[model samples]
Target: MGSDYSKDNCVHKPPMDERNLQGLKDYLINYNLPDGHEGYINILLYGMVAAGKTSIINTFFSALDPDGRTVTCVPTGMDPNSLTLELKTYKLAKLKFWDTAGWNAMLKSHVKPKELLRMILEGRIPIGTNLQNFKPTFPEEYPVIPGNAIHGVAFIFDMTTMDNISGNIMLRFQELQTIAAQICGHRVVIGTKFEKLGINEKNHAWIYEYKPLQQKFEQLSASTGLNKQCMFVVSNQWNGEHITMIKRILALYALENMIRNIDRSLKMTA
Candidate 1:
């Protein structure tokens, strides 16, 4: 086996092809915290407006249960100024997800977004603590529990529109990583709309070899100040009642990687 046993020439189907999809999906369904205390693996997701966080999340449900319909973990098409309330928590398979309100740019936090993110990791901000209604009287202080607090953080970006991300936002994401490493040592960079690359949509296995996706990964890794290894991309077939099997596996693979990254915070190597 010479470095993945495929050498560097394997393109059409590399190590991360359909072979690992079902395994990854099964792993998540059966996954549990290594500590064995049974706690939700809280992971925080952040990004700009229309970054495809909700779409990517819903797609995960479709991946997990291909025979079933997708679930709205976080409300999509949000109107922050409107009276609609956010879900208290997007809990599934003991993985709890938290996302910011869709009204304003995450960079537009009442305080710097990193500070707010810090508040989340430390477990100070409770569920439903929307930035639009921030008040000193609310959100009683608390400590980061193994199951309750945000143990990992992931930044979402639109794969189709990554070129348009501003330098300032990139810098902000970099700054946030400082807090992530210190708090939980878990951080993921996700690119949504992977199918938008110039490659054929059905050729999902060629993702790593495809020139356009490879370039986008390089660009995002460089811009976000994260390692290319920490980056993952997925196609968003969120609206489809029935997704192709390859796409389902790809989505589950992305979800599994994100969870495994969170597990690092809980001291799991794999």
Candidate 2:
């Protein structure tokens, strides 16, 4: 199905210009690295299965690619199961986006919250670990040191299915947020599948201006202690039209938030 709104029908926000993109790239290139580490800014994207994390990565690259060709560095599909089994990292200049296996209630046993927290904090996980037959490994067993730790975490959510944020989901979010806070990293929530929300181009602004949607995110932000500005509503489905612009805007917002968080951490420590 196509998006309910088109770029022409919505309020126009300036796209991320080349200058801004280059500036962000340069900033990340010189971003501070932990002692004895040799990695640049690494952002972790985590969310439920089929929440469009991979799609967001692909769309973000597509927006930045000068040739306007969509890049599929990470595999994306509508599979009921998580397509990503191991930790996969996608790099753009000095910024690296680490895509991990989707979090689902059914696979909690295979990939527990604590295990995921350890992987994120240490920034390394056993290669080729799938949901089935996955075993939590001790640090001794996985002696590999990560080049960098996660600087920011983005939680992707499918807005179409967000009618009820169950207690289990909230608990998972809280757990992840606690880990992020302990490491001085930041967390942002990205809501996808916006097209299914019945918002068209004429009222696309409502996505942000509407009180109900804003309140829902605000409640989540309050519960998780994330900055209110960290919440974003995005549509990553490429409908071969103005949806591309929408995706670009969302990607730009997400990147800006990540950069802001990293800068805040640096300032706090400095």
Candidate 3:
């Protein structure tokens, strides 16, 4: 096992265009949403608190938005409790990004997690409503509208928590993916807080060669029941302040996978 990790990288070619972050950003910015019954594509970010879903959104805008500045377009932090208290939507680069309250496995059944998630997935839950376990938050007149439904999902897992996440939590994550796959048809697992894994700017270009990431993939596979092929690692803006060039490029690489997967799902259904 040591030799395998120490040997050549599993990924021969990295997906990132280090020199062309701007160009990549430009291409995605101009990219059109594939024709669908829905007026726009809605991608939901789901994970535990501190999973970095919000940061991922900030990462996308930081790297892709024309402003060329790092800003907290979305609030994020390291607290285990969710910073996002509501189901909210942010307009970005031709898609609707939904940032919902992080999963809390401890909810003792005021509203079951899967049941609430189903409500969210079907667009039955009202945006801007506080995500809660105290009661149902569905809209009284929310008819099944394609425009309001989720188009894709990013199942984010904090690299720091994958190995030790409780069995119950892992089960919830898997269930979330199962529900998401039923709706989106394709999936991407994002392992955030990846910067802690010994990858640095000098070597991030050759991320595929990093042995730790491969091991991390195994951990994710065990936890999420998703394979490495569909998983992408990202380290969002550190301390919610400086967004390094390396972080920007890596986040872009993950976004590219997500956009491509969304496009593929669209084609398969077409």
Q: Which numbered prediction scores highest in lDDT against the true structure?
A: 3
For model 2, how does the per-residue alpha-carbon lDDT over 1-270 read when each residue is reduced to its tens digit? 134323332322434455555554445445565454455677888887778888888766776665446676666785444377666778876678877767774344655765666665675565445544556566446554566577788888887776676877778778777877776367788888776766665454345654445555657676678766678876676655334444555566567667766766756765
Candidate 1 residue pairs in clash (backbone atoms < 3 Å): none
| TM-score per candidate, chains pooled | 0.81, 0.77, 0.85
| Candidate 2, residue 230: how far the Cα is off, in Å | 1.3
Error in Å for residue 94 of model 2:
0.9
What local lDDT score does residue 131 receive in model 2, on the 0 to 100 scale?
A: 44
Cα lDDT of model 3 by residue, 82-103, tens digit: 3787888988767788888777
Which regions of candidate 1 deviate over 4 angstroms? Answer: 1-19, 66-68, 77-88, 102-109, 136-146, 268-270
Off by over 4 Å in 2: 1-38, 79-82, 105-107, 126-128, 202-206, 241-243, 267-270
- Compared with the true structure, the alpha-carbon lDDT of candidate 3 equals 0.71
Candidate 1 lDDT over 29-83, as tens digits, reads 8888877446777777667678776666667776777474655554555555423
- Candidates in order have lDDT scores of 0.65, 0.65, 0.71
lDDT of 2 at 226: 74
